[model samples]
Structures are given as structure tokens and as C-alpha cells.
Target: MRRSERSMRPRRAGPVGRGDRGYVTAEAAVVIPTLVALAGLLVWGLMAAAAQIRCVDAARAGARAAARSESGADVVRVTRAAAPEGAEVRVTRGGGLVRVRVTVARPRFPVTLTAEAAALDEATVGGGGR
Candidate 1:
């Protein structure tokens, strides 16, 4: 056999197909960033969800306060205080209902959260122990 041909021959039982050698490293190199990005997205989504829930809770609190005839300014302040940082709260009364709307800015990301709640009037619901 010529030297070139012999050298080109596949060696028997060599390291050619030994359990996908170098595959793990290559796959890790390709998939690690994607996984990291997914993790980041998951964290951001969780944060956004939490912000929304908090906004809803704040709205509920404000609506309840406003329904009690509390000062509108105080209700708004309370709502803003209850919400997460960088949040804007708006309270309005119309048609015997107190509506609270909140908008929150996400940290380290470009996102805004909005939530609204209406206060349940005691008069409308059999009165508040009046």
C-alpha cells in the first residue's frame, strides 16, 4: 500500500466514534448562551408578574380607601406607597365606583406594568354595617 493511502485509511477501534467526543463541549458552547438568555427572560417575566400583582393590590387598597370617603390625595398617596418603586397610580371616581389604575416601570429593563381595580361600594353591596 502506498504511504499516502495507508495514512488515509481509517484506523480500526480508533477515537473516531467514542461516545460523541467533543459533542458536549460544542453543544454547551452553542446552548449555554440561549439557556442564559432564557433564564434572564424568566426572571424578568417573574418580576413583571410580581409588579402587576402588586399594582393590582395597591389599586384595591386605594379603591377601598377612596370608597370610604378618604381624601383623594391621601388615597393616591397610599396607593403610590403600596406599589413598587417607579410606579404611577391614578384614582378616579365615576358612577358610584372608585377606579384605581397603576403603571409601574421595570428595573433594568424596558417594561411598564398597568393594573386597575374598582372599589366595591358598601351601599351597593347591602351597606357597610350602616
Candidate 2:
């Protein structure tokens, strides 16, 4: 073949580079799982926040009932009804004040959430001093 003709002919294709082959598929495989894990973490965080809100509400309800001179059993019942599932309620009275605490366990996380509220006991405020 003449030198000019050889130069005019097309060059043979070379083997694909390692950097280009299957790159998109590899990236997608990594990214998809990472995105799924992030979504799961976000959902778990939202659930934990909701549980914390429930605990706060339940503590407030129990504290209000206790301040109004409701019986201990009734206060606990009301708090538990307002609280999230698997939550614990505790009421304590000290020096004309009623304090209520609610604790809830997180299903996906290892941490526990706690909320507390306090109110002045109405009975003590209106009663005559000894």
C-alpha cells in the first residue's frame, strides 16, 4: 500500500479504558443504596421527633391534672393515654408543686426521650395556711 493511502485509511479502535467501562453502572449502584439509607435515616428521625412531642404533651397533661388535685391513678391514666406507645409516666408532688415526667423508647434508635412539666398545686394555693 502507498504511504499516502495507508495514512488515509481509518485507524483501528483500541480496547476500552478502565475508567470509562461500567462507570455509570458502578456509580448508580453506589448512589442508589446511599440514597435509600439516607431516606431510612430521615424517616427514623421523624419518628423520633414525633415520639418526643408525644412525651412532652403527655407530661403537660399529667402535670395539669395533678395541679388540679386529680387522683394519682387518674393522672397516670390520662398521661399514658396521651403518650406514645410503650411510654412510662411518673408523677411527683413536692412543696406545693406537681411534676410529671414521661419517657418513651425509640423503636429504631437506641436513645430514649424524656419530657417533664411542673405546675403549682391548686389545693395548696387556695387552702388556708397552717
Candidate 3:
């Protein structure tokens, strides 16, 4: 065999160290679960934010209904309709003002969202001057 022929042949790679044999597999085993959990958390966070917005809208709707002197049942119905699932509504009236609060809780996740709003009673809108 010519020296040039031996040099031209492709060299085989050296054997991997025992420690490095399953390193990539171990990393993937750990990293995949971590990544999936992170993605789940992100999705849950987005859902919580959306629920918070719904709470705010529900509160506002209830307040408007109360301000217009709608029946208590009607105000509650409106608020609940606008709120996220498993929501609670509270209405308070005083000093010619109506206040509404909405609270929401998710069954799968341990979190609570709430919002409150107030509006002047329509009947109290005007009354001034001698």
C-alpha cells in the first residue's frame, strides 16, 4: 500500500467516553418536560388575564344596570352573563351611587380574579341652581 493511499482514507472517529454516551438523551428527557410545563404556564397566564378582563367588563355592566335602577335580579343576571364561569357578583348602592363587584375563580388553576366599578344613579344626575 502506498503511503498516499493510507492518508487519503477517511479516519474513523474515536470512541465516545462512557459519561458522554447518554448525555444527550438525559438532557432531552429533562428538557422536554420542562419546556412543556413552561408552555402550559404561559397558556394559563393568558387565560387568567382574559378572565380578569371579563371580571372588569362584568363589573361595569352590573354598575350600569344598577345605575339605571334596574331590578337587583336583572343586574346580577347581566353581570353573570358577562363574567367568566364560576363568578360571583355583588352590588351596593349608597349616596345615590351604584357599585358592582365581580369575582372569578378557575377550577383547574389556583387563582382568583376580581374587579369593581361604580356609577352615579341616573336619577341623581341633575339638580342645581336657584
Candidate 4:
């Protein structure tokens, strides 16, 4: 057997397979960033969902307070306490009903969420008697 021919032949006892170089490194290079980005998106989605729930709760809270004939300032404080930071609260009353709206923007994102709730004015409901 010639030296050149023997060098080209597959070695039965070798640890490195023939033509199998850099495969692990290449795969990691492509998969690492993709996994990281997917994880980031999942976290962002959870945050958005939480913020949405807060908006709904805040609106409901404000509506209940208004329905009880609480002062406007007190209602605002109750709604803001249940709402996310930097939220805007709007209350409207007419036709024996009180409506409350809560709006907020997600942190570090360009998304906005809003929720509204309504309740009958306590004074108008069954003549406000137990």
C-alpha cells in the first residue's frame, strides 16, 4: 500500500469522523439566537396579558366606587390604585348609570389597553334602600 493511498483511506480507530467538522458549532450558532428571541417574545406576551387584566380590574373597581355614590376624587384614587402606572381614568354619568374607563400603555412597548365598566347609580337603583 502506498503512503498517499493509506492517508486518504478511512481510519477505523480515529475519534473524528470523516467530513464531520464544525457541525456542532454551526448548529449552535444558528439555534442560540433563535431560542433567545423566542424566550423574549414569550416574556413580552406574558407582560401584555398582565397589563390587560389590570386594565379590566381597574375599570371594574372605578365603576363600583362610582355606583356607590363616592366622590369623583375618591373614585379616581380607587381606580388608579388598581390600575397600572401612568394610567388614565375617565368617568361618565348619565341616565342613572355610571361608567368608568381605564387606559394604560405597556412599558417599553407601543401597545395600549383600555377597559370600561358600567353600573346603575345607587340612588336610582331601587330608590337606594336596603
Candidate 5:
């Protein structure tokens, strides 16, 4: 081949230069992972909040039921039904009142949330010292 023909041959581009003129791919690589992590965190937070609310509601329901002369086992059943998945429920009744405690455990996260509730005696609900 002639010297001019060799010179006319195109030279290969470098990594810094060529069609990739901007940081589009690099920027996307950083931004996408960050956005994905943020989304995961947001979903986890929402799940935790929902679990907390369910735990509280479960405790309140169990307390109310037990206060109305329902059995402790029944209270536990009701609490479990109302509570979020993987929740532990404890019910105690004495002195014409009932108390319920709920503990929720998150499977994906290392966290536990607790809620406690009490229901007043029927006498208190009706009137004091009838």
C-alpha cells in the first residue's frame, strides 16, 4: 500500500473520545442505583409503618374483646387475626379490665415494633359505681 493510502486509513478512537461524547452512561449508572436504593428504602418504611398500625389495632381489639369477658385465648386469636403477619400477641385480664400487647417482627429487616392497649371494665363503660 502507498504511504498516502496508509495515512488515509482511519485511526481508532480512544475511550475518552468517539460516539460517547457525554457522561450519559456513567451518569445513568450512578443515578439508577441511587434511585433503586431510595425506592427500596421507601417501600420498607411504608411496610414498617403499616405493620405498626396493624399491631396497635390488634392490641386495641383484643383488649376490648377481653374486657367484655372474652377468654384470653379468644383475645389472642382475635389479636392474631387483626395483627400483621409474624406478630406475637399477649393478652392479660384481671380486676375487670383487659390488656393486650402486640409485638411485630419484620422478616426482611432486623426490627421489631410493639404496641400495648387496655380496655376499661364494663362498670367504667356503663357508669362509675352503679
Candidate 6:
């Protein structure tokens, strides 16, 4: 080959390293599952928060019913209707105050949420007539 011809030809790039091959694929393999796990955690967190809000709502509903002098069965029924599925409700009255507590268990996570509400009982608001 002539010297001028060889000089005019393009120089070849350096050989690629073994480690560099499929680097992007390896990175993606790790990153994709991590991203999916993060998304799942976010969804679980949202669900847990929603369950907590439902517990709060249920407690409030039960407290209101108890304060209004509703029967015990009615108070429980209203609270359960307002609560999230598989929740527990408890109502108690003491010192003119009606307290309602609601608890819910998370489906995927090993977590529980509890909420309490209190209201003045109507019967205790006024003294019996003389």
C-alpha cells in the first residue's frame, strides 16, 4: 500500500472493553425493578393513608350518633357503614362525653390505623326535670 493512501484512510477506534459491553442493559435491569418497587411503595402508602382517613370518618360518625342519643346498635351500625372494610369500632360514654374509636388494618402492609372522636351526650347536657 502507498504511504499517502494509508494516511488518507480513517484510523480505527480502540477495541471496546468487556465491561463496557451491555453496560446500559445491566443498568436498566437494576433500575427497572427498583423503580417498580418504589412505585409499589408509593401506592401502598396512599392506600394506608386512605384507610386512616376512613377510620377518622368512622369515629366521627359514631361519636355524633352516640351524642345524639342513638341506640348502641345504631351507633355501631353507623360507624361500621362509614368505616373501611374489615375495621373495628368501639363506643364508650363517660362523664357526659361519648367517645368513639375506629381501627383499620392495612391489606398489604403490616400496619394498623386508629382514630378517636368525642362529643357531648345529649342526655347529659341538661339536668332531669324536678
Best by TM-score: 6
Give the distance in Å from residue 93's predicted Cα in candidate 5 to where it truly belongs.
Answer: 3.4
Better candidate by lDDT, 1 or 5: 5
**Colliding pairs, model 5:** none
Tell me how far the alpha carbon of residue 23 in candidate 5 is from the true structure, in angstroms, after superposition.
Answer: 1.4
Instruction: Please give, for residues 1-115, the per-residue lDDT of candidate 5 as tens digits.
Output: 9999999999977776676666798999999999999999999899888888998999999888887777767878999999987788887666667779999765634698999
Runs in model 2 lying further than 4 Å from the true structure: 1-19, 106-108, 127-130
Assess every candidate by TM-score.
0.74, 0.82, 0.80, 0.80, 0.73, 0.82
Question: For residues 12-127, could you state the per-residue lDDT of candidate 3 as single tens digits?
Answer: 77776865898899999999999999999999899888889989999999999998889999999999999988898999988988999998755634776889999998877776
Q: Write the residue-wise lDDT of candidate 6 on 1-130 in tens digits.
A: 9999999999977786865899899999999999999999999889888888988999999999999999999999999999988888889999999999998765634787999999999887767323
Sort the predicted structures by TM-score, highest score first: 6, 2, 3, 4, 1, 5
Candidate 1 clash pair list = none
Model 3: colliding residue pairs: none
Q: Model 1 over residues 12-113: C-alpha lDDT tens digits?
A: 785767978899899999899999999999998897788789889998888888888788789989898889887888887777688989887656347777
lDDT of each: 0.83, 0.90, 0.89, 0.91, 0.83, 0.90
60: Cα error in model 2, Å: 0.2
TM-score of 6: 0.82
TM-score of 1: 0.74
RMSD from true fold, candidate 4: 4.4
Off by over 4 Å in 5: 1-22, 94-96, 106-108, 123-130
Error of 3 at 97 (Å): 1.4
Error of 4 at 96 (Å): 1.8
lDDT of 5 at 26: 92
